[model samples]
Structures are given as structure tokens and as C-alpha cells.
Target: MPQNQPTNKIQNPETSVPKTPEMNERDFLNDMLTTEKYMTGSYNVALNEASNQTLYQDLATIFKETQDCQRNLYNLMFKNGWYAVDQAEQPKVQNAYQQFSGYKNQLPYAVQ
Candidate 1:
């Protein structure tokens, strides 16, 4: 009855209903950063156990690239306010250092 009004619009049953997207860009980037972190950890283990120089160099390169990618993603998320970090206090920092420093004496082999 009014102008610019739809008059009994027909619905198309053949057209499939669109599903909502599972993740936003921030979620996707966070996932990539997390996955890169796991890959970097595995690469560190591989590098430590590798006997061949060639394989070590290859893994090292990949590890470096993965770290770089992770940093970039982190920077992007940080800029977009998708990631948050807490500042460390001097006492907490010194305590962590002192605790880990004590572990040096527990090494299986001689430090020297």
C-alpha cells in the first residue's frame, strides 16, 4: 500500500542459507600466532637433536622465519588492541632470574 514497500516478496527455497563465519580476523591471527609458537618449540627440539649440518641450517632458517612471522602477527594484534600484556616489576624479574639461576647447579654435566 505504501511506496518503496515490498509486496509479498517470494522466498527462494533453492538458495542455500549462508552460515555465519566461524572466526573474525583477530581470532584467525591469534590462532596463527599460537600455531607458530608451537612450531617454533618443535623446531628448537629438532635443532638441538639434529646431527646433520644441512638439516640444522634448514631448520634454523625456518625457525627464524617462524619467529619473525609470530612477531609480526603479535605486533598487528597489539596495534589493534586484540592482545594485551602486563608489565613486570623489578622484584618479580629479579626473583625469576634468581630462581632459574639456581638451576644451573643442578645440571647433569659440568658448567665449565
Candidate 2:
């Protein structure tokens, strides 16, 4: 292992905005993103517990729309540099792949 590993981050230049007690564009978008996430989770639970086929289908459609909205909001935020993620190290990613690969043999159905 190398003593020093360079950290990688994915981000863009953030749009400038004044910081104040009042909500700004970033704050509003952040709040909407959070709400969308919560709504998606709720819809997922509702879909799982839905008993009627029609209701399940309706909820599924709504869930997909909500998920899409969430993704768009996330993309917007990321583009504005409001959302940043660290790039995974290659060795760690390979280790995770190897660990999960072993579990494939335990699955009931064959993977092909």
C-alpha cells in the first residue's frame, strides 16, 4: 500500500449566492430534494403494502415519476456543486466486488 493516496472528488463550481437567514435558491432546492427523497421512500413502502393490483400499479407509476424527479433534482444540485461525492479507491472497489461475488453462489437461482 502507498503511504500517500490521492483523494478524488467529483464536483463543479458552485453558483454564487448570498448567505443569510432567509432561504436562497440553493436552500430551496435542497429542501425540495430532501422532500422528494422522503416521498420516494414513502411511496416505496406504500407500493409494498398495497393489496389491490390497480392500486399497486398506480403507486408504481407514481413511484417511478417521483424517483425520476429525485434524480433530476440530484443532478441539478450536483451540477451546481451542491452535491459532491468522493471517487472510490480501485482496491476497495475490487475488494467489494470480490466479496459480493462469493455471495452469488448462495443465491437460489443461477445467474447468467
Measured with C-alpha atoms, the lDDT of residue 26 in candidate 2 is 91
CA shift at 95, candidate 2, in angstroms?
1.2
* Per-model TM-score versus the true fold: 0.66, 0.90
**Candidate 1 local Cα displacement, residue 42, angstroms:** 0.9
Clashes of 2: 0
Q: What is the C-alpha RMSD of each candidate to the true structure, in Å?
A: 16.3, 3.1
- How does residue 55 of candidate 1 score in lDDT? 93
Off by over 4 Å in 1: 1-21, 97-112
Q: Assess each prediction's global lDDT (C-alpha) against the native.
A: 0.79, 0.92
